[model samples]
Target: MCGITAIYCENEELTPSLLYYSLFSLQHRGQESAGISVFKNGTIKTKKGLGLVSEVIKNSDLKNFESKCGIGHIRYSTSGSSSLENAQPFVVKSKVGTVAVAHNGNLVNHLRLRKALEAEGSIFVADSDSEIIAHIFSKSLSRKDVIGSLEVLTNLLIGSYSLVILVNDTVVAYRDPLGFRPLCLGEIENGYVVASESCAIDALEGKFLCDVKPGEAVVIKNGEMEKFKVAESKEEASCVFEYIYFARPDSIIDGISVYDARKNMGEELARESPVEADVVSAIPDSGVTAAIGFSMASKLPYTECLIKNRYVGRTFIMPKQELREVSVRLKVNPIHKNIEGKRIVLVDDSIVRGTTSKKIVDMIKKAGAKEVHMRIASPPIISPCYFGIDMKSREELIAANHSVSEIAKILGVDSLSYLSLDGLLKALKRCGRNKSYCLGCLTAKYPLSWSEDEK
Candidate 1:
């Protein structure tokens, strides 16, 4: 997954700082790299590197980026190597003019498209799927009108994508036909903003207008906003994982509150798999809200038995297994006083490989907990996520290969229970969202057609 932001201000004063703060709010979505591009004096200038937003763009750099319109991105490398070359907002010179694009989500047909483009003499500078978008757009612009070109390009592409492009002082934001990712529009005092999540709009003190509807594009130019239907899909398949794990709890997605959805998940889990425990605790940040709901439903005392290291980023988003293990230790520590002699109910979001869950269970046991009952807020992730998430192989999923009882034994937990698929849907429905969601990773079903090998 990745985070993307764009701003178009009426006044000529630079708004790069606003982009910076917006990206900071979205830092949770990606951490490998950060970048920003500004359109100034009929030229698009970009600065990017491999690091956190703070590490990559300095205050001085923002000051130097003097422009009224700009785009920014934070990347986690779902489609390319984690390198500076793959970092965006990618600035390219198209026949129409200079354009910079920042993208979130993955293209399922990237390899085939890349080969076709290469056979036609398209020279790619970066090993990113996002670069392919730039090539297609630029090439199409050479012969077709802007809207027609975009429509054709959108039709040719498959899988999830939320894009922000800066071209000729206009900031264009578009979400794919299936709506497999989140993208929204917000209004600021002197301009408008488009971002991957609503939380970034809140961070910028902007009023959210609404979501850029599935297959819709919103263009912002000189503070005026216009909407266009670039492409259309018969069904909507917004990624449900965003509410379960990817999105910040405080954010609202597709008119549903992420925090409320998670709490409801916990409540459903409690009703489906009630456990008698002395204390109810969470696996730190992601699991805290659900644990609270579990405590309320189970009438058990809620306590912070596991204290998280505030400095450490999320371990699951880390790209490597060894790094994930090392970071897990640095990320959380058990409070012996609270855990000792206690029957603990541990609530977590999901278990992918069972590595972190095993370590956390071991840590709780070593802290003298008499028993650890694992409760996952979402259904077992038994399938790969071909859209954008990093869980790309079913072989890496422990639940895909082992039974729940076997997984419990592997983790050394007294018992394991995951929220049922029906329960998950019910919780989301309780949030009052009337939209279909993509549960491909949990259900092994996709809204869009894909090749057998791709699946």
Candidate 2:
């Protein structure tokens, strides 16, 4: 999914540098492109491109952007191509005023919505779900109040989205009824900040505020915040993947500790799928927590076997497949000392194509591990993600085509075990379940129907 952040302040300096720093805190969300829309004098000014946050914003560039209300985004390509127009926060010049929206997660009904708007003479710039939303709000200009029109707009749109909207004097954040993506709120000295994770807020030294609840909208204006629930409907199937994989380890989502969730996932994995091994290690980064859990549950010593390169850019589009391979190679190098002559149990989050996981298994063996057993924190991903995740087709998914044993053999792991669906549900409930969550991709269910064209 993509990451989005915005702030509204009356006393703090409205420098673009502030947006740059905040967006940099969220670079993990999107690697394809980045942009920010600044609202000043009833207009939304925007700067965007295909690059990192540091690459997109410059010293002179930030100086040109000055506004009390602003919205920023880093896009990971989902619905659109990797192009400039697809970058967000997309700004539109409407008759009522200038409106801009940056979004995370995917809209299932995007194709239908875009066609309807186009038939009604709406000129489009980018092939993106965010643009459909902006045009819908643009059509409701007669309603005047930004949030009210947006409320109406939300009802017509279907699927998962965590939206941050910017207009003159107002910065608002809205989560879809199912909350398929994570968004949080924070408070700075003189402003209110909304971001994809608490990490972004903490980066700016903002105090932790609660997550934007599913089916709710939070509006930050003139240093004040207001909340509104989605119109009377309460059924929300939030995305379950946030716990097992996605989010930053340090961030808390929906009041549940993400690290705890992962650790619990590992514990459950050990229960559902146990294997014999000498040492338990994790694929560098996200997989480490679950590995710890597995190690604790299985009573195996946990060791740091994979060391990651801190300088690697986001891993979504690596410029080329060759580049992606090199990047992964450069990012993680196995520790021969930890793995040598040992039967290693390697824990990882999820396996999409099985390419990376397979390579990792081979790397450990090459580093001197006697045996490599692969353990996945989540169940086999049989279907592609229609959400903001970059996985595109089932054809590319190894599990979708091959059975578990087949996949294990392909990866050259001694044995493989994935967390069961029951385990995932159990892991989340461990943190206390106050809200409904979406297990669409895992369960082959969705908040909205998937069109054949989308496939």
Candidate 1 global CA lDDT score: 0.90
Candidate 2 — which residues are off by over 4 angstroms?
12-15, 314-323, 450-454
TM-score of 1: 0.98
Tell me model 2's lDDT, rounded to 2 decimals: 0.82
Candidate 1 worst ten-residue window by lDDT = 446-455
lDDT of 1 by residue, 1-455 (tens): 99999998765564888899999999999999999999887889999999899999998897778788999999987888988999998887888899888999999989888999999998988998999998887788788866676797787888888999988688889899889989999998899989999999999899999988888998887778899998878989999999889999988988999999999999999999999899899998999988988888899999988899988988878988888989998998989999999999999988999898899899999999999999999999999898888998889999999999999999999989999999999999999877799999999888888777544
Question: How do the residues 1-455 of candidate 2 rate in per-residue lDDT, one tens digit apiece?
Answer: 78898887664356466678788988877788999888766677889998998888887786667778788999877787879989998777677677898989887788988898889999989998889988887678666576677677777887678999886667888887667888998887778788898888888888987888877889877667899875545676766777777788888888888898899999999888787788899987879999999999999999999998888964544434676777777788887899889998899988877777878888888999998888999989887778767667788788889999999899998898899988887888897766667766676766677567755
The parts of candidate 1 lying over 4 Å away from their true place are 453-455
The positional error of residue 258 in candidate 2, measured at the CA in angstroms, is 0.7
- Candidate achieving the largest lDDT: 1
Instruction: Tell me which residue pairs clash in candidate 2.
Output: 237-438, 238-437, 238-438
TM-score of each prediction: 0.98, 0.95
